[model samples]
Target: MLETTMPALASLEAFGNVTDLLVRRAADAPDHVAFDVPADDPASWRPVTTAAFLGDVRALAKGMMGAGLVAGDRVAIMAPTRYEWAVADLATWFAGGVVVPVYDSSSASQVDAIVHDAGVRLAIAGSRAHADLLTRALVGTDAIGTWAMRGVDGIRSLDDLTGRGTHVTDAELETRRTLAGHHDPATIVYTSGTTGEPKGAVLTHSNFLGQVLNIAAAYREVVTPTGNTIIFLPLAHVLARGLQLICIASGMRIAHLSEPSRVVPALSVLRPTFLVVVPRVLQKIQAAAADKAARMRLGPVWERAVSTAVARGRLAEKQDAGRRSRAPRGLRVRGAVFDALFYSRLRAIMGGRVDYILSGGATLDGALSLFFRGIGVPVIEGYGLTETTAPLTGNLPGRIVSGTVGLPLPGSTVRISPEGEVLARGVGVFAGYRDPRHDAEAFVDGFFRTGDLGRIDDGGRLILEGRMKDVIVTSNGKTVVPARWEGAVEASPLVQHAVMVGEGKPYLSALLILDPAESAAWAASHGSTFATGSPGEVRAIDEPRLRAHLQPTVDAANALVARSEQVRRFTLVLADLDDHELVTPTLKIKRREVLHRAADTIDTLYRGAAS
Candidate 1:
């Protein structure tokens, strides 16, 4: 068994409940801006000071207390990533209630499952649409009350809730806050359910404190008051929620972007020093950069530059390989020229000031990571499940490894089982799932079974091999890991998602979701008509000419793997695979869901000629 652990840092010992950070930050730096909310105009943002933020939390807590929620009661926050979401979240903790987060865009049935399972009675909605969703979710239920952040007809507004708190004294609120302990459930964050039913992890104050303090200590240089960060991912996800807490505890200046589609534009304007995101964002960035290069008729030169950089990267990773064995001087010169011409423009699009981007929730392709690093932006990959309270292992600034998930977080322990499953045990890990019955299946001995196959490298970095259940076995009995091929396929600018299917079938076939913009641009350049389709819909590309254009990308990906594992027959999907139903909130495609929904397409791929 391979195991590694980083001892807990001193910061973890200082907190009582996780909420203490807010109280302390407010006391120490009351005038410091805690968050920046975007105004109606996209170009401007409004700041919220620590003092004002705490006051809002206090008022909301009093309102929640006055509404009859007692200690241990669950209160749901159904909202997008916004200032009000943060206020409601902290207020729930201060009110001595467990925060049960619900995604603002979630369907009513999804919301209903979470609320009913968590036994939630009070939900704070971000908008009228969200209030309506919550209303539908709570129908025929225990008369759950709904409060909207924005004013809505017949729904109580956040202002109204805060107004009711005027009668409640400060001492009473303090008394309620004191009732919460380090072991109390801080939040019931539901998993995105990529594999199966979404399980609620019972994370405690200590669970979050462990992550926040360890991450702070690990990245102390970058976690500063002046650092700017934008919250664009769903706050409902553990990674984003944990990141929000980390930013608040570190006193970083934050901006919340409610729309995910506006992230790149907002980044250019906000010019955040650091960014935390899922791999999909990076994929999009890479695709756009490559598309632009191709449009400029610099594809061959760009490819050569990327190849040289990747070679240099691989050589540099070796023990005695640095400048001594770097790429040839001529190649390096050409790369530097291309970096100025192409890569710099890409960096400028992201505001040119990003120190380093921290990505988790999904694996970033190794080549893509190296390409970004070559272009002067380091995209660090981290790994963790929702049950681990955000991140249990990640690539920090100095110790980054391109393909690996760096090292275990300070205070966490990771071990590889005989079967290659990664098991974790530490303060960062949740005690268990919300359902006691799942404990036996989730934990092996004392370690939390990650259900992911991975190995610990000699350097102590963890390399994920993909989910155990996701392994595809052919009728010939050759075992294949789809993520291995999928990661390579996604590395191509033409592909958005490359899902391999053929479990118990003859050979592996792929369901390809081409990057619409890039594919369209390629088609247009090749003298073919690329028609537009509905929003997020992938337009049909069944023509032989389009397939011919995509063949080189497919051949490049196939070169990375063995013949059996290479995609045999392929079918192009006409819609974005990143759709909510097909992918998790964190952006990992739900392979089973996609296969089930696209059974007809899979059958067609198998029956049709190989692309």
Candidate 2:
């Protein structure tokens, strides 16, 4: 096993607790814009200041008191990203209760699993639609009560709850706050179980406070008061929720969008300076750029422009004193030309102000990272899990290195085991899982086993290979790490999702999904015709035009791996993979689940049948 350690940055200092940061921000910058929620008028936005936000939270906390909520009580929120979701979260903390967040898109059974596991007694729903799911889950169970953020017939609204707390006094809330402390449980965030049942991860106020302060300090320039971000990921996700608190503590302005489909339109209007995203968003951006290039008939010219820009970007990063003088004259000329025609034009789509993108939840493609850097947008990839309070390592603002989750966080320590498993130990790491049975298998000598295979480089950057459980061994006794191959396959502009399959088999195989828009563009550029389908829907993959483009992508991916690890056969699913069944909400494929769902296809592939 290899081990490395880096001391915490000198500037790293602890904020007392989650609520303390909220109180300080409200008192220090009362008029600062805290959040901007969508207005019913559709053309305008509703801004909430820090002081006004605190008032709403305090009022809701008092309402909890009026309804007999006490210290250690569990409250669940079933909602999408919105202003009231923030209110409910803070109010639960202020009322000295533990908050349980449920994904807004979760089915009735999934909602029931969380509520029952956490013993949540009170739930706040975003709309009647969300409340309906909750009501169905709570049927025949008298332990839970529900409130909606928006009113419906015979239902209490959040506004009504605040009004009901009119008789509750400030002293009562203060008394409740004193009942909790740094080590007290603040939230019970569940794992996005891509495999088995979700396990509750109990994170304390201190865990959040430490991580937010250290991350803000490390990336002080990008996470300052001047930073503005629009959150589109589900708040139930640890990364999204942690970023929300980091923005609050750093006095940054934030906006919320519930629907993923609305992100592009919102980006054009919000002009956000930074973003918290997954690898899929970056992939989409790259695909969109390619589609636009194809539509404008700049096929070869577009590819050359991107290549020239990347060369210039890398040359500019060299620290040699004569680096600028050494740059070829032709490259400088092409860089300037492309900067005006291609790079600058692309920036307009993202409001032309995005400085950095904080990506997590999956490994990012190095080629995609450089492509964005070529266009003047830098993506800072990070690594973490819900058990670690969202982030264990992250790439910093000016020191980003493509394809590596930069140095470990200030207070965290990472180590690799003999079996190549990544382990972590830190104040941010949870004390233990909610289920005692998981603790033994999850911890080794006090370090929380991450279950991810990785190695630390000389620069202290963490390079993840793949998940330990997802590694496949073939009948020939060769081991294959699929994530390595999948990342390379995605770098090809033609494929959308790639899954490597071959366990206890003679050779590796793959499953590929193609984006319809991109396929159409490829077909057009290649002098072929394809039946245009509805926008964003999957098209039949067996068509000759698609097969012609996909073969090159598969070959390009094979060039990156050994012959034994290469995919010998592949099948195109021709349909969109359902989010809940084949993958988790964060877009991580449930390997076992996907393999099970496609058992027949696997059999056909081995039988040498044509796809």
Candidate 3:
């Protein structure tokens, strides 16, 4: 067994509960701008001071108390990410209630499942529609009241809560806030795990405190007072929630956009210093830039620039590890030229000030990571699960390994089991699921079984392999780890998702989702039409042109493994998967769901091709 541990850089020994984070922030920097909400003009933002935010939390907490919210009651927040989500969340905490975050993308059934499972008594919705959604979802369950953040649809609201709080006193709120201990459950986050039902992961006050304090301490340069960020990822995700708490703990300016589609406009307006993104979004940004270049007839020049950037990135990482010398003079000259011509434009599009970006939720394509790093923005990769609050391991600034998930963050320990499963024991790790039945299987000894297979490199960085449960064993007993091949083939600019499928079959095959934009651009350049189809549809292409284009990716993936483990054939599954049920809210493609949804197509893939 291989293990590594990073000692805690900071702790909450001075504070008793999660409420103290905000309370202390207000005490130390009352006038500090905690958040920036949109002003009259959507482009402009108005700052909310720490003291003002604290007052709002206090008023809301008092209202909860008046509403008969006893300590330990669960208050659900069903909203898109916005300034109000944080207010309602903190207020619930202050009232000695557990916060239950409902993802914005949750279906009515999903909403119903979470509400019933978590024993939620009240919900704060983002709008009238969300309030209605909550109402509809709660039909069969015990009545759960709704409070809207914005609307005049006769429903109670933040203002209503403020009005009701006049009868409650300061001492009552204080007593409630301090009732929960450091390790008490702060939130019951229902985790959207792949191939399974959602489980309520009980992250405690100290779980977040340990995560936030250590992140701030270790990545000090990235979490400074002048730093700012835009939150577009659903606040329901533990990673985003952790980021929000970290920003508050470190006094970073924050702006929230309700949707990821609006992020480009928001980034240009907010000019955030850093960002946390899922890999697909990062892929879109890279693809968008390339498509623009192709449209401008700069495809050849742009291709050369990308190659240069990738080379520079690889060389930089090698140099950092002392495996290579500085970038040669010729490459340096080419890089400088590309910086002026291409990289600068790309940076300007991302608000020109974003020095770095953090990626989790999925594995970033290594080539994509190199390309961004080459262009002067470090796309750092982190690894974790809902059970780990956020990232248990993260790539350190300036010391990033292009393909690795970096070292354990401060206050965490990572070990590889004899069979290669990654085990974690950390302050950020949740104690157990709300349903304790699974706890016996979830933890081995003291370390939480990550269910992921990986290893630690010579320099102590974590490099993930893939999910142990996701391994595909063919009929002939050839064990194929699909993620290894899928990740490799997904590096192509036109491929949105590369899902390998050949379980209990003769040979391995793949189900691919080509990106609409990138594929359209490719077809246009290659003098062919881009086929359009609705989601959940499949087509077997016999076209020579498409085959030739994707064959290189297959060949590349094949080169990584033994002959029997290679993907013999791949077919297209015409899906965008943006809001598809097969995809989680965080954009994780549920492989089992996708395969089950497209079973016939996989059969066709095996019947039709052998190359």
Candidate 4:
């Protein structure tokens, strides 16, 4: 049985003012840097002192009020991660309007769906491109209006909003700010909708504030008030948005990066103390570093010797530094050398002072987690959803366990039902979905059912097993979970991602997407003839060769699963899953969609029709 210690649930009573939170922080740290952007070209950053940020926020809020946006009106913000995005979100709340966040890359149909669902009255787009996406979607909808951050055809710009600012008196502005309350709907964040139509999760100002407060208390022991963080993850997501709030309240400097490739460079320039990243970004960095190390031929003997010396230095420093319990001796040493040989360059790429990396959005591969720990930069994996305002549980710096998602955050309760689904009730929980139908299905007895299968161990760590909705049941009534098998298949050097399919079928099969760069290198090493082909041709020519290489991996994975759960066969995909279309923006695999699109190929694999 899992034991839960939850703080008394805070009341949803209104705080009666929203700008009060911002005003308090601004007064305390007026000159402290609030946000920075290292990736924006001219490659310069826009640094705002707390007072300046607050000033801009107030101006924007006043501007919205002058434009006739009343309390509870929905203002949609669709843009990439930038200072403007944060400013708009806060401004909406300050003006007592509910902010609806839409992804920058969402297609026309997706944009239409979200805007229509949220009943958005005025949409604020971040750039000209963002405005264009919305314009196409709002072709005939008169109920919705659009505003562009940059001036665009038939749309109002930020300048237009600021132009009307002089018409509003100080007393009028105060009234708008006073109308803002903690219980007011701050934002309606849409779920990724991997399984079906997306539903809007209604997060209130209090819900977001509670998340920031809980996380701050949880990591107060390690993170100092003077810490700085580089923000690259999408602010449209709850994790990134909540992190921004935490940074503000904690007096930490924040720098935003737009392009992912610029993360290393931005880090080098910012020298931030912390970063929040998804698993895919971390995996890419690890793979890149490993490839570089292999090419340099830094073999075990030299590596071990260097690692040992580095470890000793770290241990001595930790002893002198007078921190609480030091990290594992092996990890300390490996981190030291990794820092000395690799992390310095990595830090140089980041700007050098990163103290911690927070991982979230999906389950991180255990091997990848171990590798990151071994190298010395601790990657703390967290678990949450938009409905939970992002932080339900997290593995902190010193108390981390390799395979689990750590314990629940303060004031949060997590329970595993008889069916193994993780249910949560906490201060961070949202005010239910906007749709009554979704709200009914999403909650059971006041507990928000996560629909994720997981187990809590004797030590209280939460290990996520798989999604209840994605579990495959064979015709013989045997259950085969895709995540467990997919993790195993991905462990193979040749397989990048695999989608296991067997629901209502006799046995399991898969659609495999090979990692082009890794597969090509393996082909070259093995003296295979298809090493230099284009991505499509490489996949086509090397299918047989890859099939041969993956046989042992397949057999090994099968040993761990039941016969019905085992992958009976697989077909290599000729093209990568289209990031713009097939895959979600977060890079999560859409199983049902993918299976439907690849039905012919899947049928061929099961019928043994392909070579």
TM-score for model 2?
0.93
TM-score of each: 0.93, 0.93, 0.94, 0.87
Give the winner by lDDT.
Answer: 3
lDDT, model 1, position 23: 92
Expressed as tens digits, the lDDT of each residue in 1-611 for candidate 2 is 26655555533234445787788899899999989888887546888899998998999999987887778989989888888888899899988999999988776778888888888878889888888777766667654478899867767788877777888889988788657777889899888787677889999987887788778778898887887999888888878888888888788899998876777778788889998888877777766777678789987888898787667556534522234445688987887888787888778778789888888888998767777876888888899999999999987766777778877888889999988899998868998877788788889998999999999887788899999988999888899888888887766656667778888888888877655466556667778665544432333345665666577878888898889889988876543445565557776667677677667777767885332
| CA deviation > 4 Å runs, candidate 1 | 308-332, 516-541, 576-579, 608-611
Q: Write the per-residue lDDT of candidate 4 for residues 519-607, one digit (tens) a residue.
A: 77777887774434342221334357678878887787788776667888777664454453566766676777777667776676657
Candidate 3, residue 37: Cα displacement in angstroms equals: 0.9
Off by over 4 Å in 3: 140-144, 322-324, 516-548, 576-580, 608-611
Clash statistics: count for each candidate: 2, 0, 0, 8
Which portions of model 2 show Cα errors greater than 4 Å? 9-16, 140-144, 320-327, 492-494, 515-541, 608-611
The models' CA-based lDDT, in order, is 0.81, 0.80, 0.85, 0.74
Q: What is the lDDT of residue 77 in candidate 2?
A: 92
Error of 4 at 549 (Å): 4.7
Candidate 3 per-residue lDDT, tens place, 1-611, comes to 29989999996798788888889999999999989998988678899998998998899889888877889999889898998998898999999999999987787888888888888887889877778788777677555477899864788887886677788889988989899998789999987867788889899999988998888899998988888998888888889889988888889988989865677888788898998888877777777777788889999989999999999999888877768577889999999999998999889888999988999987877888999999988888999999999899999987888888989999999999998999999989999999998687899989999999999998898999899988999888888777878887777777778888877888988887777677777778788885666665544444578778889988998998889889877786566565547778876778888887778878777775443
